[model samples]
Target chain A: MQRILNVFVKYRNSILYLFLLGFSLIFLKANSNFHQLKLEKISLFFSSSLYSFSNSINRYFRLEKENQRLLKENEVLKSIQIRSNTLFLYTEGCNNKTNFPFDVQRVNIIKNSFQSQYNYIIIDKGAASGIKREMGVISAKGIIGLVQAVTDNYASVISILNQDMKINVRFKNRTTFGSLIWKGKNPKKFSIEDVVSTSSIKKGDTIVTGGMSSYFPYGIPLGVVTNLENNIQNGYYKIDAELFENPAELYKAYVIENSDFKEINSLMQNIKQ
Target chain B: MNSQILKMMGSFVLLILAQVLLFNQINIFGSVNPMLYLLFLVMYPFDQNQTFYIFIGFLLGFFIDFISQTGGAHTIASLSVSYLRPIIMKYSYGLTSERPKSILTDPRKTNNFVFLLIFISVHHLIYFSIAYFSADAFLLIIKNSLLTMIFSLILILLISSLYRVK
Candidate 1:
């Protein structure tokens, strides 16, 4: 026993380091997939508070940019409202009527990270504000991401810049659709996969959401194609596109809710079963 | 003793704040993220208890990881660096009865530069390796670590020079 004590005393620092390193490694390994997701939730509680405090101070410095963005969004909303009102008037006289399928809720991004492979953005709205998992999130200029998880008062979004996130998009005015994915490097650029070599694609062509999924409506602007490469072996084009929204500077976003989402999902599930 | 503890506490708060608020937001050259918080471990007094430094390193790193959602990459890197600090100091400055008071306050600029280089490089190496943690990302890990280490070394040197420790 005494010999063991002497050994312990002799290498106490190494033992301590090994113990602490083991502990951290355990944490690193344990925080895989679900546990990592849960860890993010717990960490979000602390990060959100810290970010909120910092954002209060930081928000003032970006007031000019914020004001300009809000003004432009307001203008877009106003134009949409005017067009929809005219449509509503025209449809009122017709027997068959069309209605907008998605509802938008404005929320503030409490914390944002774009440097990591699995980037996440936490917003101030959650279940209380009708924000739910899988709801699409959009900034003023374009699509941001989709809600991954939700707490009582906060929702975490998987940013389009994340490697794991794949958004379905297509060239504006073209029928060919491709999957947009981040290459885990640039915050502003994403690559479009599965676009055929024969597709009518060009540099400076606009990319927009396909709206094949319930998350986003068709025609929401995503970005512009910046580069294109032909993969003769795969018969697919590797197209690079620049995002419209500067995610690092994004503060306000709109959470989109598809009213028919539940009905459509249940029907699809039934068909699969 | 009380003043020393107080100074360390102040440094802990200041470094963490600067890391989370300022450096975290700055992504120079797309991938080079300067982890200036490692400066705390770099500037830690060498004469302090080795075990205590390890614990402090763990606590400091864990706190940053919790905030940044990086799991325990920082904790592992910080603890390893802190544990190896004594050996690093011994090699850089040679054995002596009294350790150098501060890395920045080292009169020999070359020694200080060497110490900073090894310290930041090791930290970044461990940090980026764990962060990427994949066979395919080995090249990415090395690229990120080297790029970040260079920038971090420059920033740490600049900050330490401006900071005069009495």
Candidate 2:
């Protein structure tokens, strides 16, 4: 027993090092598996506080630029409203729920780190705001990202700039669809692989959500198609899309709240089971 | 000893905040990120216990990893640097009877700063390489490493120049 004690004492620091490293690695692995309790709520609370602090300071610092952007956006919105009103006359007692199913919650982008391989965006919204996992996010300009994890006061949206991102998008007025993904080369451009050969998608054609995502309503703006080609493998039409919103410049965003998301998720889970 | 510890802790906080808030956000290319945070581990006073030094490295790395969500990249990188710090110090400053804490060396010794630069560069290379293991972008890695090294050296030198150790 004394000999064992001596040996243990001799290598106490190394043992502690191994122990701590092992514990941390285990925690990381477990957290990665999606089994660990999501600390997103805690993240949300802290991030929201951070956002509030930063926003006030930034608002003061960048008032001129902010005003300029607001003016531009306001003018664009006014034009859009005018065009829409002229194009569509509302029929008596007609409700177009299909046009916008998701309640958009505007959240400020608190922190953004898209330069890294495993990049995530922190926004000021949480369980308190009814934001949850898998809900889509969008900016006034266009589709931005989807909520990956949610906490009570803050949530992380996986930016469209992420290389791992895959969203179901199709050309406007076309049945054919393809996956839009970032090429890790440019933030503005993303390559859409596996677009079918039959789809007559041309450059500058608008692409939108295929109505397949439960989070987003059908026909939400993605971006204009910039390039199209047939891949060597699956022979699907591959397209490069110039995303509407600049991920780098994203300051404000909207978290989509779908009323039917729970029902859809439950049904999907049951089907899988 | 107490004042030194407090100063070290204060410096570490400053380094971390500077790293995440400003430097991490500024991407010169797609690859270069300024790693001023490593200076905390790099410039620990020689008198500190080796185990404590390693622990500090772990904490700094772990904190960075948590915020950045890059797994154990920082922790691994920090450990490698801290582990090799003694050897690097021995090579540059010679074996001193003093503890491993940084001492006020003359600013005129560009050779010492160059040695320190090489040490930090090697540490960063090990770190970036491990962090980007599965990535096929070899040229990107090299570019990032070079930029990071340059940025780290400049930042560390600037801080060192400004810092007055009483």
Candidate 3:
């Protein structure tokens, strides 16, 4: 009994180290079989509350800048509203939530990241605000990201800067399209892979959401081509484009819940099976 | 002893708050955001129970990960560093490893600098690895780890110096 007690005291730190390390590794959502949803909910509860509280404090101090940006956005909106007044049929359907293709919810971006390739953003709106998983999020200037996780008062967005994110985009004023994937290193630039070199791409050709997937509405401005890497052997080359909306300057965003998302998803699933 | 414990607790909250609020928000050169929360474990006095320090490391990492929404990446990295810190100190400090507090006491010491480089680099490597979680991103992992380490080292050295014992 004395030897056992002595042994326990002697190696207690190592034992504790192994135990804690094991416990943490098991709970790691990246590669662990932990209770994923339960842990996510618990983490969401704490993290969302912390971020929102902190964001409110920050938002208080940035009221002036926020107001200026809001004023600019409001002007653009006024002009848009005025133009839409000429099209009563389109305006009427857009006002009615059911007839609208996507439901838009305005949320303050509490946190944003552009440094890491696996970057994510957190917004003040969430499940309670009608934001759901796989919903597209956008800033007024351009596309922002897609909502990945949601809680009651907050949601996490897979920012377009993330290397894992592949956005379906097509050249503006043309049908040729490809998927835009962040190539890391630069925040403002994305490399459009799967774009065939055969296409007569220009130096500054515009890019926008393809809208074929129905994730985003048709004709949403994304970026303009900056450079191209052409390789004859591969037949597929990289098209580098500079994003319209700088990732760091994102403040307010709209979570877009596609009305046809469910229908389209089911159709895809059925077709696959 | 009690007052010292309170001071440690106070800094624990302050450091993590500063990390998530201030440091996390600033993205330098568009890629490197300093992981300032690692400063707590770096300056943590090893005079305390080793097991207890490891637990505090876990808690600190968990809290940061919880807020930052990186899942358990921070938690795993922080705890691993917490466990390996003593051994690293043994190497960096060599003969004087018995007096680990000396490393914190004299922030300008050569041994302390070595310790910080090895320690923060290891932490950043583990963090970026878990973050990317892909074998294909081997080059990326090294790039991020090195870049973030430079920023983290600069910040940790400057800030932790403020608390350096006279």
Candidate 4:
């Protein structure tokens, strides 16, 4: 008995080590089967929660870029809506006619030049898609330009940012009309020339296209009044407006064809004769 | 004595956090994940009781297995290494069982390097073998163990050089 006790005391640490190691091996063998599935479930719960928490943080940083992408997608949908002729046909008492006076064809801008004074845009549609010269072009946000030239498969547009381009515009209330023209300076801004000084235009009035010409219909948005300067000597208001359409970022456009353009021109030629 | 115990407890928590949050997610060369949690076992004071070392190893391994879903592989491997660590130290550093502190603080870099290499290789061998327990996966086990051992050794040496215990 005494010898056994002495040996036990002398090698207690080694005994403990061996005992625990054997216990661990047995535990491993026992839990190697179905219990592993349970363990995996528990671990998945923890790791997935941690991953979602980190993912939420990552998503917050990308919200602005996501918003821009959504806006672009919305523009594409709006262009499709215009091409199907369902957008403007909702006006009261205008449901009987299936074909409206104007037809819109959606086209993608293949090439755009905004830095030069005489900016021009090339679109993917041409005479093959019924596109021709003197047709109005507009983006989802506002008016872009007019179709200046066309080939069998493509059309070049006289951009609204060009110095030679001008379009008739009116205030939102239809109180006064003016000519919208770019000043060869800022691409994002254009000046409404020939507005009489007696006009009641404010700093933030909404401007839209005037239907005086046969190209564009009434009430297509153009821009807003950013600055208004009254030239007392010239008796006109040098109205500066900020454009809604960004020329450099114009990806899609709608080509508006006035179906009665030839009839209206021929009637005016007969009157002149 | 109390401060040393507190420091050990702090190291225990830190090692587990680092293993779960960082090291487990990192896969170098598409296969090698440096097992940095083993540093706690390697850097534990050698002058402590052997039985206590084994108990700590089991606890640490069990906790890591619970978090990483490794199902007793870590526990078995860690316990084996902790139990046989004294013998390895004796063989690698020419030290006896009575003077264990000299092995850690010793100035000879080669002896320390050899000791760490042997210890980590043995741990990784047992770990990979148990984790991938299949006859067809023999080459896979060896390849994974050897690659992990290399990366773990580099990381352990770098961490030790930065923060010397003594």
Q: Which ranges of candidate 1 are over 4 A from the true structure?
A: A34-273, B95-98
**Which wins on lDDT, candidate 1 or candidate 3?**
1
In order, the Cα lDDT scores of the candidates are 0.82, 0.71, 0.80, 0.81
Against the hidden reference, what TM-scores do the models get? 0.44, 0.41, 0.43, 0.48
Query: Candidate 4, clashing residue pairs?
Result: none
Candidate 2 steric clashes: 15
The full ranking of all candidates by TM-score, starting with the best, is 4, 1, 3, 2
Write one digit per residue (lDDT tens) for candidate 3, span A1-273: 999999999998788888887777665755443436545766798999999999999999999998878766764573344234223334564455554556556778999988776989999988887888989888877878888999999999999888888889888777788998888878888889888889888889998777666677666778899998888888986788998878767887776668778888999999999
Report the CAPRI category for model 1. acceptable
Maximum-DockQ candidate: 1
Q: Which ten residues in a row have the lowest lDDT in candidate 4 chain A?
A: A89-98
Best by lDDT: 1
Give candidate 3's chain B TM-score: 0.92
| Alpha-carbon deviation at A269 in model 4, angstroms | 4.5
Q: State chain A's TM-score for model 2.
A: 0.64
For all candidates, state DockQ relative to the true structure: 0.30, 0.07, 0.24, 0.23
Docking class of 4: acceptable
lDDT of 2 by residue, B59-140 (tens): 8877877777766667767766775676777777656533333634544365458556767887788777655553465776
Indicate the residue-level lDDT of B106 in model 1: 66
Q: Counting only residues 3 or more apart in sequence or on different chains, how many pairs clash (N, Cα, C under 3 Å) in candidate 3?
A: 0
Mark the regions of model 3 whose C-alpha exceeds 4 Å error after superposition: A30-273, B96-98
* Candidate 3: clashing pairs of residues: none
Tens-digit lDDT string for candidate 2 (A101-172)? 356566789998778755689999888988888888877766778898988999998888788887887677
Model 1 residue A225 lDDT score: 92
